[model samples]
Target: MFDITVLGCSGGTLEVGTSAYLVKSSRVAYQEILERELTDEIVAVDCGSGLAKLCEIVYDELCGEGDSMATKSLSFYTKDQVSCLEKFTSRGIKRVGMQLDTQCESTPMQVAWKLNHMVKNYLLTHPHLDHCSGLVINSPSFGAHSGKRVHGLDSTCKALGENVFNNVIWPDLTASDKGSCLQLCSMEDHVPKAINSTYTVTPFKVKHGELTSSESYASTSFVISHRVLKRSILMFGDLEADDPDTPNEGLNWKIWQHVAPMIVDGSLRTVMIECSTPNVDANQPLYGHLTPATLFQELLRLRDMVRSLNGSETLEGLEVLITHIKHENAMIPDPREVILGELTELKTLHNLEVNFTILLPGQTYTVS
Candidate 1:
């Protein structure tokens, strides 16, 4: 079974945190369960802001030190005061900064520095700050000695290079203090990129169309498969299918067509998708995000595609674990309920045994 930890699974809102998931494919032996060591190779899908909260939770669980970092946020640091913060930092946490922006901040560079021993491979779905800002700060903080790799689409990489890492808003972590700890790698759509001997990651374009010329963003979903475990997890970064009312369109259908083949082959075991709002009315549909209703529609399309690929095979044991639900708003009803309720309705309508799970922050799930 592959284990996935919900680091920070909120939507675009910083107050609610953002996306950052840790996946581990390795399993401990039955006899060694008690003494199981943490996985050496940790794959991060998206490390956005609000990740400091997850860091704090993990810190409390592991070190029991709740007094030092009572305040969350990593923006308190100003590039020049690394030495001062390191004084109070834990062992191996080479540096520290003042508190960051609590709503849209990541775990301090020191925290990441302390855990830099683990091989981290970050995969970016897009260049949105809520999706990749944390990675930008933390990955390169290990300085000249670090070796973190970030994978993204060509356009996504270009966006990061021009906007985030061009020594403008932030220093290019890929080239700071001699060399960068983070190495940016560009990925091609629909091509299987091998992470190691056991794991492979395939990227597919999603329908997060551009908003403005400056904010020309594109999204790429991922399919992660482990050869040894024989399990695959499909992650939809952020999506919205073409609107019958708009002139812009064409990413979601193509992605569906590419993934439907895998579903028929039974290679895709679990789907970790995002549902941002309850319905289209509550969402800014032009921005390319999904609501519960849109997500349901997407699933219907998926069902039809899978059926077209392979006659009438029951999609039993398929897991649809949802992520990236927006935070509760005073203006609208709670989206979590609406999303789960919609999924329940779909299960009843289809009479399928597919499992639907809601990923909450700090929760751990095993998807096989």
Candidate 2:
């Protein structure tokens, strides 16, 4: 149903695709659906602000960060960022950007507003500061600007907390026609992509490390199910793998029961999940990430689960790809190949027979 592409694995925003959504926090990866047929239907999830900070910090080492021109006249917020909203919105004929961030800077707020104020346009999924970060994407100086017919699934606003915008964290900027357009719905209150669709999308909360461990900040993971294609993908945005039973040891359980069932339910042919470290050695705490070996463990568990669920003696040959590898670790001469080799070793376990790949930005997978 969809051609899966990996933008960046380590959950930060890396400029490796035509349309980018950097999951900028502890959960590090982004995906792009590069179907030439769906150009007008582009969708982006979360864009991490942590990426802006990291980019600037490593800019000189990577030959300098921040667009010299975009930053020249733009008012400064965080060090490396430039206002991309105004520049983007003005050019917007018919394009949609879903920002899934905790905050929307002042400048982007003004620029993001679709130019036409009176038209009652609709928002597809839910709109959060992250889901609508483009408001400040071009960095329009915040003030009263244009508004569009903004729609959200029933209770989208409630999920965000009634006064999320008015609080200290968000821009809290709304157009004059906000209330009128907000009440509109597409029949059911759930996300359009969640129910009956060619390609299915399900959003649920998962724990991931919080570099910015503020109350205002939180992260969630999503599983994309392409029914006709018989495949599923779960990306934990800044996901942490801790289990309540193992409280002191925050494993960020990558293979939780809820997620596992979903993966198994699909007639999945290929799968990709985050493995944030090269080895546990990458970070001693290992609080919010999984090692390649652990990812392998999960796949083995899932393979068996699927077999039992179907009550079939045959296994559907699960192809699991380990992703969200950090750039510094990935640069270590043939890192992905090393990870792949390890996954191959795991295939020897009984009837597991899993195929795996370590993700590098801009990597693409075609599921037949």
Candidate 3:
């Protein structure tokens, strides 16, 4: 089973919290699948904001026995903020899939800095602030011996350099210590990179609105696989689908083709997608994101793709975790309820056996 921990899954700002997820492989020897021996290794997906709440959860798990006052200060976090980061001592986490930089309001950077010993690699989906701002704020700690490796597409790395790490807005972390500390690795699309002996990550391009000349935009969807665990998880960063009538609307459909075979074969265990807004509230043109309607359409297309590929195959037992839900807007009121209701209706109408999970801060689940 793969351990999936939801740190923060809210879209945009931290009204609810931003995107951060922790994934750990419960190591099962390939030869001992029947014997069920397990080892523990962890990798974080995204490190968005919401440090206080995340710390609260960890604190409860680690220091529940003691009075709250006694455990007030546990490293960088203070009494008012919250801290139980020491819980990570149970497992080793070396890599983060998307390197989300810390925000001013929270201490995500401090948390990362405190745990730099275990953090070695950061795989970035895009250079967007909500996704990568944490890395910028914690530059001092990442320099020198505590340096961390950052991996992303060439375009993504370029965007980060020109927009985020530029000295004007933020320090150029790459130039620090003569570039010895923070190692930036540029990745190519479709090429799988080994993240360790157990994990391999493959990046695929996805359509997320228009990229104008002035915009330094680059985003991707990722497929993370564990060879020994025989499990894979698909993660979609912020994205939008082309118009139905447009000839190029098949972006996700094509991706479904690449991923459907694994889902059908039961090798892909979890699929995490962002549902940023309600159908009526999504401004696809202004901000590239997914609404419930578009998301449902994509899921239907994926189902069809699987059926066409192999009629006997089904998505049964495959877990679909919806992440990055936008905070409740005045117009939408309760976005999560509305999205869940719509998804439930669609599932009932189509009789999909797949399990659905709505990711929230501090929630953890097992993906097998």
Candidate 4:
């Protein structure tokens, strides 16, 4: 089982909520977490938003001291959706609440400070600012002394080393010397690397979009697995649909082929993917992102692949958590609602059996 906490999930247009997630094996007890006994265990999938959001969660939801900002954050969600969030969050609330009570002298910031230190490995998909700003901003607190490792593809690591952490936009923290805080580790495609004793992550390269007419931007999707249980969650970075006009158009198909067997074997059931916009004109520039219509098409491809493997065309038991909705304008309908409505219409139109949920920040989900 994996417990995933949404630190932030927006694609852009907001600073406080971007695309960060905290993932941990359910085996770690809350008491053990409070005691700070684990090492190299907590894994941060992305760090677009971090400590500040954690502080908000602790203060408003767990401590119940603030003006219910945490609850207000979910105002767009339906009551049933909010109830689901509460159900998932309730699993850890009691233990976390107990820990909060014991640390009465510690303000929310202090508690969040200590909690943030538990993350020893950061798995980055790309070097986009929205996906890594928190990692860059929060490096000073734990990186220098803790020896935290940032794992990503060679291209991703190289970009961070040369562009972001090269003493201009940020300090030179990518060195292995004692003064540096972060160590960049390059990962091989499709090879699983152990994050800790309990979890392993396999990276798959996908095409994000075009950087130039001849050059394409690359992002990644990760298969995070429980070593013993064999259960996995597939998490994707920003990506465009497989357009034949684009280079590497079929890369998403390769990912679908790779995971179809896992789905058939029942080792993978949850997929967290990005849908950056609602349905838009086909000619509109996506800038390497997905819309609900495009995302549904991709899901149909996966369903077809699963059918070819197991003669099962329906992804009935699968959970699809949509992430990274880019809020565009205040005059328009809320993008989340627009995307959700479109997805619902498509699902019903085609009788697709997947369960789709829009991810909200400050929520926790337990997937088994």
Candidate 5:
């Protein structure tokens, strides 16, 4: 089982909460959590929101702030699941039914710091500012002695090294020498790289859209699997539906084909993807993101692929955790609500049996 915490899930409009997820193995014992020995076991999928957001979450949980957004988002989890999450938060909060000292402030900061330290690796899908600003901002606090590694594709690593961490914008912390805190590692496509003893991620390249008329922007989707249980979850970065007019047209189809067998065999049932906007016009520019109509069409294609691989025609038991919805403005209705309504309509219209959930910051979800 995997415990995924939505540290942040906004596409670009929000400042504090914008596309970071902390993934931990549920196999770790409760005693280990109490002992605070989970260092190097936790991996963050992105770093758009990091230590500051984590601190905020810890403070809210400890002080009974009852942030309405968190409360509403967490309502999706059962009581038992929320109880398990309390144990995962801090040593002061034990298993279900234990009392926590809500008055203490230092304990919450300590817990937040410990949780931040547990993240030894970051598997980044791309280096967009909304996807990596937190990582860049929190580098100084990572401790020079800490051997933290940032993993990404060659283009992503190159972009970060040349543009973001070039000492002018931020400190040049991507060196491997003793003084540097971070080591930037480039990963190859389709190769499964072990992030920790418990988890391995296989990355597949996907086209994000055109950077220029001649150059296409690149993004990635990762299939993260538990080594022992063999269960996997597919997570995507910003992506658009394949357009025949683009240079990298049909690239998204490759990812669907690769994961169809895993879905059919029941080894993978959870997919965390992005739907950045509501239903837009056919000619509207997405700028490397998906609208509700485009997202549903891509999912329908996946369902067809699964049916061809196996005799099954339905995506039953599939959990689609939608991420990265852009908040355009207050003048318009909430994009999340609008997108959810459209997705529901599409699901009913096509009779696709998939469970869709909009990811929100400060929520914990367990996938088994």
Candidate 6:
């Protein structure tokens, strides 16, 4: 069975103990299973702290401890604050932030802090709150406001270890005593504490077509080699490319050909690619997103490329899991499944030999 667990595909955290989940490849040893693996540390790709509410906390401080404020949009703090206001936080929340948004199917607002805690390593696909909010280590607020940003919280840069939480967009969480203004984390902060694993995480910027070329959501790709469990799952936060000016115009295949082959170059056990829509849906997949049809075409193209390269590594029967379905085409009952069904049928017809799975909400698949 898969050690993975899906919290939500297109929305909210499943109620605790809900069993609407899947386990794909669970082959852990008796002792491994006896010892809980998931823990409380997280790897966040993005953090979107609401400003109006955050400022209100500072506003309350200026107004005086019990002083009431007119409006409190939302503060990025814990729930133990003053009267009439509740903090927006999860007990296990981490302060790891990045320069992106969150996943559409992202509900926990985190990628998961503790994946089998016995293994302390972590990986995040890109900068997005839905994927990273669960792991943010800290936020940077001015000390004048309260001796520290989100005052007195231990989520400062040093406390987080190797970061200067980017002051460009978010405040510098590092203390002035640390000698840095910015507070963003470096690559070192991502590796796990132990477990004798060869896991490595790397990010590469990818340009999507016009349809997906929005600013706040620029796409970045993630390649994680989870050496411990011998698992590797690659996914981009959220992605898209601009369809040409013409409605019928599609992604530039020539450019894609150049990059596609390289994507499989990395050695991995399993690769989770994001396929968000059906080809007829019109959005370009792979810029940071993938439509079922586009994904089909891309895979075929990739298979052919691999054959031509004369490489023995064939994904013909390789397990390929698809994630990040758009609200319209997702397996869920939204209005978009009409065309989605057609696209899924096409995939079935191809019977591409590769293990294809459309990840469901709360679903977990093994890594075999």
Judging by lDDT against the true structure, name the best candidate.
Answer: 4
- The per-residue C-alpha lDDT of model 4 at residue 17 equals 80
TM-score per model over all chains: 0.76, 0.50, 0.77, 0.89, 0.87, 0.49
* Candidate 3 residue runs with Cα over 4 Å from true position: 28-40, 50-54, 65-116, 179-181, 212-217, 246-249, 281-286, 328-332
Stretches > 4 Å off in candidate 5: 29-31, 34-36, 66-106, 244-249
* Model 1 deviation from native, Cα RMSD in Å: 10.5
For 1-368, candidate 6 gives per-residue lDDT tens digits of 12444333331121111111112124443123223442221222222222222233233333343223211211112245432221111122111111112222322212121121222223333444444333343222212222211111122223333332445543444546555322333333223222222434554444344443354333444544344544445544445543335312332233234434544564343455555555643532344455666566666665665666656645554556555555442244432233345445765797555655544432223543
What are the per-residue Cα lDDT tens digits for candidate 1 across 49-124?
A: 4246446644544454432332232222223432222222223111111122333233434343344335457788
Task: Please give the RMSD to the true structure for each candidate, in Å.
Answer: 10.5, 12.5, 8.9, 3.9, 6.1, 14.6
Worst 10 residues of 3 by lDDT: 88-97
* Candidate 4 per-residue lDDT over residues 72-148, each given as its tens digit: 55554444443333422212221122124544677778778778777778899999999999989988777565768
* Residue 66 lDDT (model 5): 43
Candidate 3, TM-score vs. the true structure?
0.77
lDDT of 3 at 244: 68
Better of 3 and 6 by lDDT: 3
Q: Residue 224's C-alpha lDDT in candidate 4?
A: 89
Higher TM-score: candidate 1 or 5?
5
Query: Each candidate: what lDDT?
Result: 0.64, 0.38, 0.62, 0.78, 0.77, 0.37
Q: What's the CA error at residue 200 for candidate 1, in Å?
A: 1.5
Per residue, candidate 2 scores C-alpha lDDT tens digits across 186-304 of 32321325333333555554444454555322344555554554455554444444543553343234334445555455444445566655555633765555666666555555555
Error of 5 at 19 (Å): 0.5
Which pairs clash in the backbone of model 3? 97-123, 100-134, 101-132, 101-133, 101-134, 101-135, 102-133, 102-134
Name the runs in model 4 displaced over 4 angstroms. 65-70, 74-105, 244-249
